[model samples]
Target: MKQILQSLSSGITEIVEIPCPSVKSGHLLICTRSSLVSAGTERMLVEFAQANLLDKARQQPERVRLVLDKMRTDGVIPTLEAVQSKLDQPLPMGYANAGVVLDVGAGVEEFSVGDRIISNGSHAEVVCVPKNLCAKIPDPVTDEAAAFTVLGAIALQGIRLAQPTLGETFVVTGLGLIGLITVQLLQAQGCRVLGIDFDPKKLDLARKFGAQTVDLSRDEDPISAAASLSQGRGIDGVLITAATKSNEPVHQAAQMCRKRGRIVLVGVVGLELSRADFYEKELSFQVSCSYGPGRYDPAYEAEGQDYPLGFVRWTAQRNFEAVLDMLATGRLDVAPLISHRFPLEQAPAAYQLLNSSEPYLGIILEYPDPQQPNDLLNPTIQLEQEHTQTKAFPSESHTKAPIPHQPVLGFIGAGNYATRILIPAFKQTNATLKAVATTGGISGVYAGRKFGFGLATTDPDSLLNDPEINTLVIATRHDSHADYVCKALNAGKYVFVEKPLAIAPDQLDAIQSTYTSILNSGTSPLLMVGFNRRFAPQIQKIKALLANLKEAKAMIMTVNAGAIPPNHWTQDAAIGGGRIIGEACHFIDLLRFLADSPIVSVQTTSLGGVELREDKVSFTLSFADGSLGTVHYLANGHKSFPKERLEIFCAGRILQLDNFRKLKGYGFSGFNSMNLWRQDKGNTACAAAFINAIESGQAAPIPFEEFVEVTRVSFEIAEAARH
Candidate 1:
């Protein structure tokens, strides 16, 4: 499948071949017919991407602040690399699409194979859209017209906020596509509408859509016209749909609206406001979110759980259906709104026109053979690369490795962590970089070239089943860890999987049974979970310093985890296994390693906060060796604070590690403070251990038993949190 991807580094859009995403449960696999390019929103992203580093920094000062914070804790070199890696990622473009359902996943009954539907899918040849974001198209609506459904929902949502009525007079600030759509929809409600824009062509379209035009290009003032058009009574409401950094739209909206009138913003603009302008009229201002209520809610869109109509009258999907019904009838005419059309292959030229002053309204990208299905849609597309440079290695104790004759590595997932940390670590070893695989072939291409992989592919199963690959690294999503581990164990390959191993008890049981069965069959492939913190040089030094002490140690570990949005996948238990299972396992494992004992028993409790819903929890670990450890993982901390702090005490001697970059020892004879130029979370040692295990035919650095223990403890903590 071919999809349009925008490079943030170069702001270049190219059609690249990638594996068609598999249809997941409650989702539809759609073959795209046409997709709409939202001019206002996409143009901003493109321009931002095209900007220089300094200009980009100027545009998003918040991110710059974050970079500074990272530098303070992680050091300058790591922070710069982090920023560059983020900028190098490919951002998928477009959201309004019309397509035929190629297949439907489990429990998706509303639409099935061959159903022509409109969705919030991107400009891809194939897309797996969640069922809630996918709406069935009416019989009379053409694909191009249906492609406007998602964008139409945006306009409808803004009007919904304005609360227009039959006898009301409303003004739409800006005659863009959304503004024009809002005009027609408001007119359909029997409201007198006036549209404002600097472009005469947009104003002309607004006039054709049954709106009174206020052309700023012709020096027509919207505020004066609104008062005149409303017979000196002032407009009932204003919908600001303009995209600019100027606050003029809101100022004019305030001036045009009557007393106690409503103002809804459906676009981006400078929000500098005068209190007096709004104070005298007591006007209401609201910024309509993307599409509608269910747009950013994970339970609603991702989980396909629709809000009941009795409780929430209009969801994003409901808004999409409403727009489609209007198009099916003659009430809404998007056919005339489309000013330009280009085939999907020439999407770059369409964007160029949108970026230029070429005067386009509803730009649509038509797909070739819209209803046809490719014979090999799910086949793995090998991402071939010409150069595979060996990465440079620093003079480090952990990274130095003996050259191996037959070590082959197949890595799954080429995401940020893998690209920035693990793969780079593995490249310093003697292991042959056999293959790199990811869901998207583009990322695989990038990772393969950068890490010197022999082959880059879209199929993890192919890499796993290959006899040439003796080792496999599973760095994919949390939900996928268990399955990949089981597969690798069954394939007789040494496995290094990132934590946490499993989310559910059944998954853990499956992994344990598979690993045990493989071991019983005289096949002992080393199994290691990515618990890298314990392998850190700072951590190792602490362990050796406390090696002779028999007294129990008391440790306190605080993780100022900051905030992950409630709608992020990390908060979704089914996807990311919640933060505790997905992330806190590292802390749990590190405590066990430092204590030199398994966690005998544990209890957990979470803090409650208003408005900020996150997992702010505390847990106590009672080790078998009589050591006690407490973990305080707080998400409400300020971004400027150092994220992690650990203090351990034994026999009144204290050891402190701050953010893994600096270590301080107190009440001890020969140690004051040990510092590093950059933070090392032991990624180098972690990767080297796994590669060295295969090379030396030795056991894993961290045993499989410890992996199971940490995974079990995490699950228990989550279970306790439920109460």
Candidate 2:
């Protein structure tokens, strides 16, 4: 399917054909009819993307600090590579969409095939949207008008927060798409409206929508204008919906609002508040989130968990229904709001206009008959001219397919981890780099060219279905690991996936059942999880020393993991599996490796109650060998401190590994300390081991049963912690 994406590094927008996402449970696959180009939000993104590197850094100081911290832990070279890889990724554009439902995923009951719907899906030919984010379009609304549903909801949410009543006067700053919509909605509530903006065209549209206009470009004093519009009394309330760096909109609204009046902001602007403006008047200020109550709650939006209508009267989807009702009843008019329309192919021209000084109110992108054939939507789309994998190093020139004895590797995800570590490690081995794939074409091509891949594509199944590729390396987000592993095994190829193996027991069960079937058929390929800590040089040395001991070992592992922002994908338990399954699995697997036995039992605890935070946690493991292990994984810690520390005691001897850089041994004669100049967490050795095993037709370095056991332990710990 064709999708539009914007390059944050270069500020370039392009349409690229990529794999269509499969409709997941509780989702609807919609073939887009029209989608709105948000003037205010998209303009902010485009301008931010067009800024210089230093300017971008200044815009996000927190990310800059993260980069500095990475440099101190990881080397400067790797940190630079990760930063470049991040910037090279293209971000998907647009949100408000109107489309016809092509198919409904399992567990969805709201809509079926051929139902027209309005959703917060991006600008694409096809979108797989969660049911909660989609609302059915009434027959009276046209596709172009329905495309404005999400924007109307944005405006309505702010109005809801302001809580205006009949005869109240509300000042709406910035007569852009959202501001104009706000004016009409306020008027519908029987409140007097005053609209403010610098553009005369928008001011005219506001007047058409029943709002008194305040043109700021004509040196109009908004404070006096607002007071006069309120009939010598200050405005009852104010809604600032302007996108600008200047805080004048906020300042003016605070100044013009009547004493003890409410102010709600639904736009992005500088918030340099003055004490007098708010304190003297006793004003109540609130910044409204996009759409409304259930916007970012994964449970509500993604998992189909709806709040009761009586308890929460206006959820995001409820706001959509309200806007549609108004449109159906002839109360809200959107025909006069749309300024321009472009087909999906010419959508680049629409984005170009966003950067220009043109007057655009509600620009819409319409989709016509899809040019792609039906077969292209299949799991695999093959391309001719596959790269020959056996080309020798340039110094030893030979162009031919690699010998069957060697492993031909095709990477499934060219993300930050793969770009910084896994790809670089594979460069040293004799394995063949056949292909690479990512969700976006730019990253796939960029990392492919940089890492010397035979081909690059935006489709995962294209790599999986290729006959020349014999081994698959999975490094995408956490949730998809098990599915990729199963596909590779079924395709008769070896698999190496980063941990944790599976986020849920059901996914693990599927993998186990598949592996068992393969085993019975004598077509099973090796499967390994990248629990690289067990492969560390110091760790192996510790294992060898422990083998000579006569007593069981007690271990303590402390991880100062530090914090990631709450909104990061890794924090989404449904996607990245949260911290326990995503990262703490390493410690769990490492302990199992040292004990050389299965984990017998698990227990866990956390610092927060019912808050569901994975940041601060402690868990204990009981190993079959009678050894006990405790891991204290704390995310709220000093970044400068060593990330990991482990201590082991057995047979009157103590051994400690500190951040994989130093191993200290005590209470043992003739045993000396070991150190490395740089930290080595065993990722390189782990990749090499997996490749060498495949080349030699040997058993996987980490046994498949151990992989399953470690994953179960991680799950148990997380479940116990949450309870």
| CA lDDT scores, all candidates in order | 0.86, 0.84
Q: Candidate 2 has which clashing residue pairs, if any? A: none
lDDT of 1 by residue, 1-723 (tens): 788988888889878777676677889989998999998988888898889999999999998999998888788998998898888878889999998999998989999798999999999998888899989999999999999999899999999999999989999998788988899999999999999988888888888888888878789878789999899998999999999999989998999989999999999999999899899999999999988988888788768899999999999999999999999997888888888999988988987886796778889899988333964266455444445356322123223442443467889999888988888888888887778788756677677766667666777888887777778999998899999999998887888898889988899999989988988988786889989999899999999889988999999999999888876887778888888898988999999999999889997878865443336889999999999999998888887788899999998799999999999999888888888889989989988888888877788898889889989999988777655
Instruction: Identify the leading candidate in terms of lDDT.
Output: 1
Instruction: TM-score for candidate 2, please give it.
Output: 0.85
Provide the TM-score for each candidate, comma-separated: 0.93, 0.85
lDDT of 2 by residue, 1-723 (tens): 678888888889888665566677899888898999999888888888898899999999999998898777655665676787678667889999999888888999878888999999999888878899999999999998899999999999999999999999999998888898899999999999999999998899899889888888898888888888888878989998998889888889988889899999999889999988999999999999989899998789878999998999999999999999988887999888889999899999999899898778789898886564343343322222323343322312224544675888888887768877788788678787767777644455545656667566667887787677778899899999999999999998889898879999999999999999999997756999989988888898888888888677899999999888776777777888888999999999999888887788887879885354576899889888889899999988888677899999888889998888789999877787988767778888999998888778799998889989989888888877666
Top of the candidates by TM-score: 1
TM-score of 1: 0.93
